[model samples]
Target: MSVTRTNPALTLGKYVALLAYLLFALFPLYWLVKIAITPDRLIFTEGTDLWPSTTTLDNFRTVIFQTDFMAFFGNSLYVSLGTAAVTTILAAGAGYAFSRFDFGGKKIIVAVMLITQMFPLLMIIAPIYKIVASLGMLNSLTSLIVVYTAFNIPFATFLMQSFFDAIPKDLEEAAMMDGCTRFQALRKVILPLTLPGLGATLGFVFTAAWSELLFALMLISDNESMTFPVGLLTFVSRFSVDWGQMMAAGSLALIPSCLFFIFIQRYLVQGLTSGAVKG
Candidate 1:
């Protein structure tokens, strides 16, 4: 057997480059947390300081208690989770069908889906708003969920289709030959392998719904129904902005996304490796 060797100098350089990239990427997050804890008065004064002379939990406290923060947070969470689940389920079924079946209008349907994605959201916002208004869905969380699910399904279907493509049809066929139904074979053999794809689709849909402001702003006029992104605007006034409280709220908003990624990170890694390796 031959031993594999790596250049120490090259390895060190790569590590240094990776470290630099990480720092560059994470600096904004670090600054967000820093500003969240920094006292309001000291924010501008100590903005450039690596460490604040003083820090306080007052911003977090006020945000959590005195404002509509929790309500907005809850609204955002509900919409995002609802959208993710609905979109993923529909996308998975559609993807599997697309992958396994040859049906009439298959190419045309895919082309339409692609076309839908090509238009800027601005162009369709008015039409979407009109449709929602006609349906009496304006200012409704359920409406937001429905709209998000619709918008996400096409791309998510394509994503899941790619994952299904990576998996061999022979696996399901063999299971069917073993006296299992097609659904059974899918559940027992194929679904488990598609976990990475499902996780990725969920992450994508969740992030999309969570950060969506335009549709929410257009459809939701009520203060109570406003999602977190729109609610963040409350911290801004005509004359001045509440930097500390805004930053605090922004920092808090990142928790769900981070926890979600942490939960699915393993699946994401598996997806990367699954693409890299071949039989």
Candidate 2:
């Protein structure tokens, strides 16, 4: 009876602690939502209030209808999708080769890939800029897509290799034994089963491409070509910043990323288990 009574108190304490931690961690997002909705006049006045006395949609309205957010959004979407698709395809092929083949210099190739990942991205910024300029692809969205695809491929290949390694080789051999070519087995059998891995890789590469800013800033300068992350910088200048509108745009920016995850949530969790047992 005493233990049972004490258990409730412990559980209550844990809940209180968890609630505190959650509120603390989520405070910035809460503040973002708060400021985005707070009347511009009241933003400074109610700055410390937990809840604003009144809220408005003016900021969101301004960001969506009054700004170049839509164009920036479209550009970002195009680059991110292109990068994700290409990176996933390349990573899938490389991963398959790594998982299924024993080749000369396989370890050396993998070691080089790993080494590329270990270097700071900042170290190669100048060289990349030079290469992009030499190709005359500066200020182009295609350039961003190509750069992002290359940068993401190594890590993504490792991730794909893990997924491929998990599937049983016997499955492929069985298909071959029944008169199917390896390519046919890969397409008709392995491809269908690899949906989760593909989705996970697609989601990862997409998210990385969506959020990338430094490279976008370096490569794209044309107003028409600027991605959303770079456009966010346009919110600032030699003058004061528009905090409310910036936050509003930021809040709106989250929607696509949220949607991407919504589409991948099933595969995201399953990818964990998919990599557990390598056959």
Candidate 3:
């Protein structure tokens, strides 16, 4: 018996659709780079030009030397990394429990977590501010890290639980039969397989914390403690906004996130679900 292959026209159409989506998603990034490179004098004059008539590194130089750009970048990095680490650890534990155990109020706990995500963050900002103030954590990087971790944990836990659920319970059972403890089985047999999910969770949480501005703005009072997103607002003057510097800082802020994803994109591509299902 002969089997028919997919129609070439259908394959071609799918490729065209994918290419269109790629262009749509990438156009904004292209605009950012275009604007960042265009000279201040040519910014408005070159309206809609694909290429800049003139390019200069002066904006980047001024952002680096004349402003607190580096400090803000460092602060953002600290908070993002801290939040990712803490949230990942907590989520991993919670996800494992959710995946492996059945206990009283499990449904209620999951429902509550889902409910927490349903509320608009703005609604809780007042209560959060009061709590942070009572704890004397305002204007501190620790406060930012804590808040970001708290907000990110529920989603990250769900992410981790999905990954854990995709893993085979048979592997752990076999490992235990081979004289390994549950923790050892998880470490050796499961963790290596879950690298893609971990990388994705880390990337998501890091980006979320890195670009967060509202909470950072409300919780921080000191200029020195401002994150890069909040610090971008500093470029705005009462009369004239520093468009050049703000865009420069904004462009610079993209570097770390880009670099982070680049570093993890390899591990993130592996199909952790390959052995998850029986044929």
Point out the higher-scoring one by lDDT: 1 or 2. Answer: 1
Model 3: how large is the Cα RMSD against the reference? 4.5
lDDT score at residue 153, model 2, on the 0-100 scale: 90
In the range 159-241, model 1's lDDT, one tens digit per residue, is 78878998999999999999999999989999999987888989878987998988898999899898998888655542146
Q: Which has the greatest lDDT?
A: 1
Residue 23 CA displacement from its true place in model 3, Å: 4.2
Question: Rank by TM-score, descending?
Answer: 2, 1, 3
Residue 69 error, candidate 1, Å: 0.7
- The clash numbers for all candidates, in the given order, read 0, 0, 0
> What lDDT is obtained when candidate 1 is compared to the true structure?
0.87
Q: How well is each residue in 1-84 modelled by candidate 2, as lDDT tens digits?
A: 455455787899999999999999889878888888988888778967988899999989998998888899999999999999
Off by over 4 Å in 3: 1-23, 237-240, 261-279
The numbered model that scores best in TM-score is 2
lDDT of 3 by residue, 71-122 (tens): 9889999999999989988888888888888999999888887777778987
Q: Could you tell me which 10 consecutive residues in candidate 2 have the lowest summed lDDT?
A: 270-279
